[model samples]
Target: MPHSPMEVTRLTATDAARAARVLDEMRASTLGGGRAKLAPRPAIRESWGRMLHNGIDPDHDFRTDLLSRDEVERRRQTSRLRHTLPVLREGLLSLADTAQHIMLVADADGRVLWREGSASVLRKADGQGLGVGADWREETVGTNGIGTPLVSRRPVQVYSSEHFVRALHSWTCTGAPITDPRDGSLLGVVDVSGPLETLHPCTLALVDSVAKLAQARLRDLHLTSLEQLRAVAAPVLARMDGRAVAVDKNGWTAAVTGMPYTNRLALPKSLAPGRCWLPALGLCSVEPLPGGWLIHPTGDPEPPLTAPHILLDVSHPRRWTVTVSGQTGSWTHELTPRHAELLYLLALHRDGRSASTLADDMFGDPARTVTVRAEMSRVRRYLGAFLDHRPYRFTEGAEVEVLLPEAPLDLLPHSVAPGVVRARAAAGGQAWVERAQR
Candidate 1:
């Protein structure tokens, strides 16, 4: 088997020639007969499989058409990744240049949108077709750090011959994926690369750390935007009477009046001025606000207390959907992994859960009520009528059912929320105990 990354790093450090020989053997076997006695590292081998299946030619110097200047500018204007560029450069560019490496940032689609660092490295990169607008997706260019990390959704290092393409064997690259904090959607990847001689085992860790810093900066920007919207909402909500709230375009609650404070309101994909049925607070009149929308509860009488059927499906790897059926009709809402965990927790404890209890469950910290309350507010937007607050709970008349994955371990695969983890552990243990009894 191919040595572990740590072992390879150590070998490269102490016996570079031997390590190189092993890599050469591995590559020769893979390309010539696909019967390499020594396999590459798991990640690299997996990436190679994907590239081969996609019909990528390892010997050919692949280059896809670059984006037009106008299109590139348009992407920069619209991409959230734009806000992270400064953070990435500040964290990486100087060090990368000094180390004879280049720092490159590619969008989710693997299009290199920004590149900088050592001039020599940049020129070498250009020759390798790694310039801005180049498609470096695994299928496009074979396994390299930028595209590989995006596909793996983690930090990855492609060292010398570990790269699937022959042309990339002279270089080493480390990259980490950056995802949106608001949602788990990938924004892009940030990578540091140089000639094979510059391979430093620490590069992957450094890139991963900087990627996290970029995400932190993005979170700060999101919070700042919310604060500004809150400022604009204050005066508007102050004049409102009876249940009204000012919410941003994404339904982040900026201000609320005549009701309990909520973090966000569920909003339709498109907001237009008029009366509409909102999941939370029943029917409401919506009006365009400066940075968001003004929602006013129409004071419609609460529907009869007929038990609504709620089905929480967490079977999918990436998505969770909640289906609600009752007097009006059935509506389904797709939830983020975090929201899925929260809803699952709420369903488990049908009686109710205080903000602090939920915070503790979701984050392992009772003080994280702000985040819990915010997410719950969003949940209410779609299930508001079926939910009740002040120690949030499904309305007493609602019947809740949850659909779990066939394999208990498969539940909420992307969720790191403490509640989901605990649920998984508990279910796994129960399964094991049942097997033991049998």
Candidate 2:
């Protein structure tokens, strides 16, 4: 039986050398196709499996070409992480320096964008190819802090022999992913790394804490931007008549008139001033505002003469989108993870589902109908009448097509919803059967 991750952490902090030896033995036995006296932690074990499947050599260090200096600068300038640098530095740098650990910030793709902290640790990291502009994806560097957290979408710590690659076994690293507060999209990862002797169980918690503070900073900045946009939109919206809304670029509403105010309005990827079909507002005239847009219903019952076609694409591992097409125009909205799961479930059961049923499917608790209903309400605002709420389903006559991932297991990989889990299992089994028959 595997010792729990907590037990491993306690042992590592008190007797790192012994813990390292145990982990090394476990790694060797497992990688050598034999059962070990103890099993690796689930995260480490899963990562090792991926490394084996991807043919990442455990004994060799594979390095990709680092990005050019100019490219690194460009990424820093454009990344939203730049805004939270102060928060990250204030919260983590001093502690990291004192602990002889170097702090690193990597973009969502696992390219190291910033590296700082102890000068000695910086030199050590340089010798190990952990410098700025280096690619640290799991596929590129095997199992480590930065890449693993990006894949797992959570904080992770890799210590000593827990690393899949032998070269990285001498290093200890902890990382936490930072996501955009506005849309819940991943921004990047912040990590603390040092030599194996510096391993500490608290490193993961500290890094995770700082990462959350950075997210809070980003959330504050987003709210400030929304306020500024609201100020600019107030006068424009005040003069407007009949169901109109002023929304920021990300579809966050600043103000609304002649209709119930919604927190957001689903806008298309490419928007312009003229007649456009919006999700909630139906046919609307859209005009650019100073910081956002002014949209009003054009008073047409249906979009021109064509029924809407909806496409829900959950093929991508991290990003999901819903596209609506009509005679007037076509628009696509990137979906948050929860919305993606709900839409996928609805697509699966076109007949419809009760709120309680959806709750049970999503949370494994039938009594959580309130939570399901609230999320569904938000979905309806963006989906408009295409979604029917009596039982909750796509409109009967409308064409609803779902684009799924080529690999069943890749579908909504981050989702823990029971429906998605069951779907993945069923689909994987079916795929295995098909392959066997062929």
The segments of candidate 2 whose C-alpha lies over 4 angstroms from its true place after superposition are 304-308, 429-438
Model 2 TM-score relative to the real fold = 0.90
- Model 2 agreement with the true structure over 301-356: per-residue lDDT tens digits: 87453577999999876788998877766778888889999999999999999999
Error of 1 at 6 (Å): 1.8
| Candidate 1 local lDDT, 1-438, one digit each (tens) | 345556777776566566777788877776554556566675775566556545678889777789988877888788899999889998888778788999988898898888899999999888866788989888788889888886666788888888888888888889998988865667889999987776666778889999999999998987887788888878878876788988877777778889998776666545689876667667789988777788999987756648889999987544578887777556666676577888888988888899999898888899999988888876766877778888899888888998987665457644556777678768762343222223
* Colliding pairs, model 1: none
Single out the weakest 10-residue window by summed lDDT for candidate 1. 429-438
